[model samples]
Target: MTETHATNPPGAPVFPPGRYGRRREPGRRRPLVPVVLAVLLLAALGLGAVRLYTQYGDPAYDAQVITYTDITDSQVVIDFRVTVPAGGSAVCLLRARSSDSAEVGHEEVTVTARPGERQVTARHRLATSERPFIGEVLRCRAPA
Candidate 1:
């Protein structure tokens, strides 16, 4: 008696027709998508950083609080120094806070630097509705 056997190719194993669903070929990915997306993300981040720096970061009009004294139930005296360009002026925001971090008072003060002067010291008396625990110079900007 003689016996017969079936042979298959070296590639993927063959399945019986209709027994399994049709197979699909691997699809190609486009490399441009990720590059475009990354460029867009970076551009957005750069724009945001530039806007923030322009709005809040001015090295020429920097301000620092030197001392806070003459504290009372209804007022506080804030002594601060502002660094401005020579012969320039700056507008500073002053704030007073209570012991609980509540805003007791706020005011905007303008300081001017004389000729050949880059730093100017200013003192402001801020009025409040309640007692203040601290006085601070929030920020300074070039005068408009």
Candidate 2:
């Protein structure tokens, strides 16, 4: 018995004409489109970041919680420091949370720096309905 082999043409395999619809040719590459889109996306993100920082972030008024003590069922004492523009004042938002991370109390306190003073330490006793596990200074802003 003799073995025979079937030879096919080189290049893409041929299919029944029109059975799979028209074969699409490779399209032109538009490298510029992706580059342009990436540039626009970055520009949009930069603008958004700048807008948010201007609207919500302030370096002139900053607060840090030095310690949280005197935790009790009714209150927590939060000792914090606020840095404000020299001789300026700030309104800070303080918060107390229970062990489960639930906000139990929140308050706004005003801190003032005397002439030539840039930092002021403040202590606030926040009243809560339940026992608080931690306290913090949420944010500080120039008084309106």
Question: Candidate 2's error at 103, in angstroms?
Answer: 0.4
lDDT of 1 by residue, 66-88 (tens): 99999999999999999998888
lDDT of 2 by residue, 13-71 (tens): 76665578976765686699899999999999999999999887866777889999999
lDDT (C-alpha) at residue 11 in model 2:
58
Best by lDDT: 1
Q: RMSD to the native, candidate 2?
A: 8.5
- Backbone clashes per model, in order? 0, 0
lDDT at 109, model 1: 95
List the global CA lDDT of all models: 0.89, 0.88
Query: Candidate 2 overall Cα lDDT vs. reference?
Result: 0.88
- Poorly placed runs, candidate 1 (over 4 Å): 1-59
- Top candidate on TM-score is 1
Model 1 per-residue lDDT at 23: 51
